[model samples]
Target: MPAGSSTGSLLQTLFALILVLAVLGALAWFLKRYGPKVGGGNANVRVVGSLNLGGRERIVVVEVGNEWIVVGASPGRINALATMPRQDAQHGDHGGTNAALAPHSPAAHSFADWLKQTIDKRK
Candidate 1:
């Protein structure tokens, strides 16, 4: 093989590698800028709260429509533990203060605490 031919082949290989990387970078940028949203921007379903139970288990409170759904999630399974009517913002207030905003209020308990109490009540 001629010396000039070998140099030309090396340059061609480098150029091809650079071109492939440029295309991949552009594709990534396009996807990140105009990709579909994770939840599809749904307004009806919202996560009210969540509590970690163990290494891969969690209790999640999801607000769907006009109700709150308590769910237990672990790896591949999600179970509906309970359901309750959604508490409106107006009903969350006591006197002139919101119970959730009051640190010392009984209703200010964390989601985990509330779930514990609810489970205890059922027994």
Candidate 2:
């Protein structure tokens, strides 16, 4: 093949690949933003909060109707860890001040603190 024809073929291939990637990226973003609400936002089931446990595992707190459920999620499986009534505010305080009152630490309580306190209370 002539040098010019080879260069033209290479350019065409690169343009086609770039177009496919752009289309795929747009589709992915669209799906991630709008996919979960397929059942409609009126379903009354929503994720209140989530904590990553590394890799694909995490703990997700979901509000289903008037109930709050703590779920352990990994890959294809999900397990309920705890269930409680949907409180006006998480951590029992209606004022939304569930943070540790330590002067040295930040006012906002980390998920670890909340998890530890919840576990200690159980014991």
lDDT of 2 by residue, 26-50 (tens): 9999998977765555778887778
- RMSD of candidate 1 to the truth, in angstroms, is 6.4
Question: Mind sharing the TM-score for model 1?
Answer: 0.63
- Per-candidate RMSD, Å: 6.4, 9.8
Model 1, residue 103: C-alpha shift (Å): 27
lDDT of 1 by residue, 1-123 (tens): 699999999999999999999999999899888986676589999887677889999988788997778899999999999776665555564211221322333473445565665687689
Model 2 score (lDDT): 0.72
Top-scoring candidate (TM-score): 1
TM-score against native, each model: 0.63, 0.47
Candidate 2, after superposition: displacement of residue 63 in Å?
A: 0.2
